[model samples]
Every structure is written in structure tokens, then in C-alpha cells.
Target: MFSFAISKSERNALFHRRETMATRMFLNGGVYSMADSGRLDARVEGLTIDPVDGRVLAVGPQCGPVAASDVLQLPAGAVIVPGLHDRHTHWLFALFANAVVLGGVKTLAEAAARIEAQLAEQATGWVVATGWNTGLLPAGLLTQSWLDSIVKGRKAIIFDQSFHGALISSTLAKEIVSKFPREAIGSYHDGVIHEQYVMLAMAWMELDDWTLKAALLQRQIIMGRVGFTRITDMGVMGFPLLHALQDIYRRGLMILPCDFAVQPWMLREDPLLSATSASVLHFQLRWLKEFADGAFGNRLACMCGHHRYSDGQGGKLLLDERRYVDDVLLARERGIDQFAIHCIGCAACEAASTAFGTVMQRLNGESSGCTFSFEHFETVHPKLIEHVARLQRAHVRIEVCSQPGFLSDLTDYTDRLAAHVMARINPYGDFRKEGLAWRAGTDGAITGDDPWGGMALAVNRGGEQTITVPEIMGTFIDAPLAVNGPATFLILDRDPFAHLEQLGQVQVLETWIEGRMVFHRRN
Candidate 1:
């Protein structure tokens, strides 16, 4: 249902066409467009928007002969900036995942109260929930017996903090094993189902089209509240969720745009893949994602030297080199040009880099117009950088999608490696110098998906590798509010550019997508 242009010529035609009737104009606001550090400049007076295409028709000082009917007069001294983009997040999952969220619950009693509340409300359905931090409930206490005592055999699944896996009650586990015949998912060691295998176990849980619509509505509501006009979801699973998104857009209920990665194995029957389409305005299914290693809390983060959970020789790779390479190359053959690999540990990072290098080599020394990103590149290593540099030399672009909020909320795995070692390993400054592109992501659903908060965390890291506000914002923002750009932007209460310390405190008074106001704070 999305109407985006794929080719450069098509976009050029859209941009070059003469402006149509300016249906709306945002008047009397300080327009602040961000650019690279070198160009921290420029201010505009207003923007005239074309309703038909949802793009800016005119810029500053182009005072209109248009009628006053379309004008939206700004409040005294309102500041209009570009709408925010969360380069990496799970906006869909943030709303649709578990009805009962247990994030930040440090005590078992608190978790029980929430579960019982959900039980009393739903009555008969499964108590599907996520956000069970290993630190919140240590491995020893995270057991079937422990959960059975609380839920009393009611169908319940308390997934990990990241929702990568789940700890199911015996009742639900039995039902899952009976339905899905997979050894990896069936064997619930310590009552924990690992990574992608949990997807197989989740076959028992199903939602109707109406529920998906409601979830989609909630997803947009939160996006507006958080000032995010665009989100890049890590991965989107199943055909129903995809169709639900399309149906929402068809009904004019979609307020923002989303670019998401897909798991081909999950979408094997999808006609969208069969069409081999790259993307439209709202949805992008060209990127394929895979997890090279499990999460750190699970002690399955493949690392070197010492790890508290896995074998001393370091953790293990969820997808070994050969399998990963085969899957990537196969997806590439099917027109998947973008690939996101989950690499939280140095050992996992190394393995992914090597496999990607093989992918490049298979292309006969060319990158083959493919992109590789390391999601949550938490612990970067010099050797990993060297591998990246080699790939870069061959024109293979590598992106690091980092979640700074992890530093604030999740610090349980910090002690596993020395501070100095990690500091020396994750040389972001050097990465920048070598022309490696990086972006800040909130890892939403895992952490709060606020760009301002993400900027604050990066600037306030209080370490040698700490980045400046300009450094982080440069990832998504650009200057001067280009005329042909989509009319997606935000309205803030004050001049966000000047106040560095108050970055975290800045509030989004309004959020607009394609010139239409989607979110207006009612303060």
C-alpha cells in the first residue's frame, strides 16, 4: 500500500514537478535543520506543504498568495525541526509483544503481582509476557518449579528481557512440544528456550486481525508520543503481521513509515518475497537479519578470554560460519542487499566479520552492492576493525547500529571484561576516522525509544569514547530543511540546538508526517 519511488529517476520526477496547491503551511516557527558538525547552521521561517504528496512545497520567505485557510500559526516562538528517526528499533514489537511487560522488575514478588494481574484479566488465555532480565531473576531462580509455584500451571511464558527467548511454564511447554516437533525448541533446559527456536515454540499463541489492528494503532500512538516519525525495525516475522501493516495503511490509519528486515525462512510462503520488490513508502522487506550469538544476559554472547556463563573458550555462535555464509549468500541471490547481524560480544563480532569477508570474496573482490551492519556492536575489537577495513577496501560498507541506552539500563555484563579493555576495543572515534558509518538506536522494547535520551546517553557516557551531541545527531539529521524532502518533522517547545545539557529533557510538542500532524502534546 506504500507509494515510494524505487529508482533515482522516479524520485527526481517527483521532486522536479511544479508545486501544487499548498493545502497547509506551518507559519511563524524557527526551523532548525541539523547537518554535519562542519555546518551547524541555517534557519528558515516556514514550510508550505502539498497535501496530495505530503511533501514541502515551499521554504522560508516564499510568502504565499494562498488563502489563510491552510495556515497553522505556531505558538509564540515555536521551534520546528525535522522529525526524528530511530535507526534501529522494534516499534511493532514494542506495542504488540506481551500485553504484560515485566521490564525493570527486580524482585520476584513484583513479577508475580504483574503475572497474577494479567491472569485475572485474561482469565483463560496464556499469560504471554517478556522483559525478564537475567539480573532481575538470576539463572538459579529462573526455573520451571519456581514459575509453576506462582502461575500454578496456568499457561504462561516469561520471555527474556530482549524477547529473543522465553521461559515457559510446563503446561504451555507441553502444548508447544506436542505441536512443533523440533529438538532445539522442545528441550527446555532450565525452562529457557533459546533464540530463534522460541519462534517455533510460539506457534500456540495467535492473534486475530482486529487485535493486530489495535496493536498497530497502539504502535502509532507511542511513535507519536515519542516523536518518532520513522523507525527501522530489526526484524518482522510471519505473514499476518506484514499483512496487518498493509491493511492499516490501506485504511489511512498509518501515521508514519517503517523499514524492517525479514527472516526469509519465516516468510518462505510470502508472495511479497516472490515479487522481489525492494520497498515502498511504508514497508521495506529487502533486508534479512540473523543472530550470530545469543544475548549477553543468557551468557550465550560469543566472547573471548573469559565469560561467566558459557564455556571458558568463550560462548558459541548461534549460526556457525558455513551456515551463516550460505544463508547470507542465498538471500543475496534472492535480492536481499542489506543484512543485519546481531553481534554483542567480540568473538561473535569476529566470526560475523570473517563470514562477511567471505561473502565479499565470493563476489570476486567486490561488495556486490550489499550492506552489512553489526547490531549492538557492544564490544568492538581492533581485530574486528581490521577485518572491516579490509572489507571497506573492497567497497563493502559496514554500519554499526549501537544502542547507548544499554549502558544506562543493562550493566550486568560489564564486569565480564575489563573497562580499559572494552574502552580500548570499542574505538568509535577511530571507526569514524576510518570512514565507517554508525547510527544510534534505542533498541526499543528493550529500552526507551527516545532519540533525545539516546543523544544524552552518548554525550554523558563519561568516558574516553564518549561522543558529542553533534556526533550522534549527524547519523540521522541533515540541514536547511530541503524543499523536496518528505514533510516529516517535529515541533519542539524550545531551541534544542542551543541547550546541550537539557537534551534529555527536550519535549516534542508536535510530530508531523508528510505535512499531517500525527502527534500534538496536550500540555
Candidate 2:
């Protein structure tokens, strides 16, 4: 097997500098800039950007000197807003050409058709897909044999929407079972693997650089189309994915900024590249990622009482409480300043928080300069919320990288989770009421990477959890879109505030990263 290697010349080429220019661009529009105290600003008629470096020159009441030749007026219906930042995403597979998405399949016949079509494309090789929503079909209907029947001669694996488990066909099972640990037997189904085994399943598919290139090509088109300017990749599994991205960035193909996670699994496969920190100009390995527990759809998000997935045995923690505490210190040793732990269940959340507290206790009030981000913080028992707040006081910098898209998974939380557990599902309002740090992400594992689609979920969620359009938009933009910030933003076709109910219909006319226009909707 060929390893990903970069020569001295190639490494130097990654940072070749260019002279900066003073070219400027001016836009005349009714802009909703985060500049005015982060409140949905009054109609700002002028916006200026230094096109050379893509930094905002001026906007709203702070409009500075402008040249008449620079003004570019948008169409009458255009609505300008700050570019979206997705806090969590698996960038590699978001648009992988071969990785078919089953998020829309509503029936077994539909799923079968998709698998067969993908198999037909290749005479031999595995057909990998993800985003298999459990609500689409009866859970009993999807099994290894059921998947095998879809494409008899080919190897196949369809990962569940939750990204915590999967159903593998027999042919692929033979390839994955040998190394599969016997003690880690799965509980979801006959041939289904859950928790860390999902990583093991993906490891079976050794994607080459060529396969990855096809997927990398979709990064700009797909991400910009969905209105994202900066994406924080949750973590990528294999070496080829990161290497493929590095190659693209080397060739000046990267269109936007991304903070890629340096996952623990990558240390064994690509330690040199993983430790380098800066992979390319716009992509950096800034966050170290790990899983704390399984997810909701798998009936495995460690609950307290009898929920749908458990009777009394609340789900699972990927590691014991002691292991998590050790890992926190290990993260500090690795020089990882940012840590993202995946936790969905209340018990899982508690375990992760306690581990952070343990490390702080050992520090005795010394700051390690490391921040902790909890991914998929969908549930937390009311009592544990205060403990989390106290941990923050003790200097375990905490933030929730939440996926609002998961709200679509459950129609009525009361019907699925226990009475006590259901109320806490994505309790954003509670987080706000208690002053918790939180941000939005389109997980892409279970949902598509559409900021508007995710925002629509929050807007329509009406009740304590429902957030005003501007407040939810803040989660995507990071802060007020003030001067000197990156000239990355979007042109929506209509006013968002006026049509909050129709957010799903809002169209992105253009997406600009820096001063460059990356995506323009075809007329």
C-alpha cells in the first residue's frame, strides 16, 4: 500500500507567498450585518470589501471612503447576510461521488434501487452509503441479509442515519469480521456494529487517492451551495481523505477555510501529517476529536430510565469514566488546544463533564489553555446542567457543537424517549436560560449540510426551544459581521426575517469566500 508522502519541495510549495494588492469591491444592498451589536441591523445600504485579501472594508453606518467605480449593486430582491460556519461536519464523505446518500430513501424498494444503481457503476468493489434514517422503514426490515439481497454479487454497507451503527452485507462482513473483537459484540441487530466499530467498518474500505479526488472536487460546489464559508470538520477517519485535501490545497483548489479535527485514530495511520498542525493554507488540524457515547437513533444515547432503546440499562459510554479523565490529560500532552467529544445521552454528557472536572481538580485551578467542545449535545438531565455550569467555572472551557438537524429525527420526543428524557432533547432554550456555550452544526452524518434547512428546524420548532431567526443566525455566523472580518457572506433571494416560516424556500443566490465568489445560482 502506498502511503501519503510529501517531499521537502512539496511542503515548501504549500506556503508560497504572493504580493498583496489594494483592489476594492463595493456592494449596495440592504444588508443584515452582525456589526451593529449582533442585532439584526437596520438596512445598511453600502458594503465595501478589499478584494485582494477578502476582508470587509466597511459596512452599515461605518462605511468608509469608497470609489465610484467599485460599487456593485445587487438585484432588487437580494438579501445579504454573513457566511455560515458549520461547527461539525465530516468533509470527506459530504459529497463523495461513490458514497451514495440514503437520507431520502423512504422505502426498502427505494433503498434497494439506490444500492443496485451504485453497484452497477462498478463491476467489483464495495458500495458504501450513509444517512439511512431509521424512521423511514421498520428497523426489523434492515439486516445484513436484507442488504445483501439488494446487490447480490457486490460488497455493501449502509450506515444508519445516526452514524453510530451500520448493516453490512455478507461479502463485506467476511472482510470486516476477522479483525472484529469478539467481546465488542453488537446489540443493535444480528449483523449490525455500533459505537467504535463504526470506525472499524469505515477502515475496511481503504479509499485510494483517486477515489478521494473525485470527492474533494465537490467541496467548494457543495459547501458554497449550502451557504457555508467556513466548516469545522468533526474529524476524518482515514489518511487518504486528509492527504487528498492537502493535494488539492497544494494545487490552489481550496475555496474556503476549514478547521479539520486531528482525530485519535489518525495518529496510528498518519502521525507525521496529523501532528503538523497546518495541513495547508486554509485547512488546519486544530481540534482533537473523540467519541464519548453512541447516538439517539441507535437507541443507544445513554439514558437514565426506560427509554425506547433501553429498559433500565441506559446506553453506553465509549470509555469508562476513568479512561475519559486520562484522555483529557493525554490531549493536553499532545498539544491539542481544542478537544471535541461526541456526547448525546445525559449520562454520557455527565461522564465527559466529570472527566474534564477531574483534570481541572488535578490542576487545582490552573488553566491548561485547552477548550472542550461537546458534539451532539442533544440531551442532558436537568440536574446535570448545574454540574456542567460549575465545571465551566473551574476552567474546563466548554462549548456545545450542536446539530439542530437532528431535531428532524424525532417527530414527537415524548413518544420515543422517556418522559423525563424527552424534554431535554436539544434544549437550546435551557442552555440559553442557564448561560451555556453553544453553536450550530449540520452534522451531515445524519442530515444534509444545509444551513437554511437546519435553521428551518429551529424556526419551526416553536416553544421554549424555538429561537428567533436572528438569534439562530448568530449561531451560524459566529459573531457580528463587523469590519476587518473575512469578506465571506451570502446573498439570499429574499428577506429572512419577513419569511421565517418559509426559511426552507430561501435560496442562496451567491456565496462569497473572502472576495471571491465561489457559488452563483444559475438563472
Candidate 1, residues 242-308, lDDT tens digits: the string is: 6667666654456467778876465344534621554555766667787766442334342211113
Highest TM-score model number? 2
Report how far residue 424 has shifted in candidate 2, in Å.
Answer: 2.8
After superposing candidate 1 on the true structure, give the runs of residues whose Cα lies further than 4 Å from its correct spot: 1-26, 35-37, 57-59, 63-73, 91-98, 178-187, 202-204, 267-272, 275-281, 294-316, 365-367, 386-394, 410-417, 421-427, 478-480
Poorly placed runs, candidate 2 (over 4 Å): 1-22, 61-67, 99-110, 180-189, 206-208, 268-273, 294-315, 363-367, 389-396, 412-415
**What does candidate 1 score on TM?**
0.84
TM-scores, all candidates, are 0.84, 0.85
Candidate 2 lDDT, 284-375, residue by residue in tens: 77787776664423343632111234433343455565655565555556556677778877766766676666656765655467777778
Tell me each candidate's RMSD, in Å, in order: 6.4, 5.1
- Tally clashes: model 1: 1
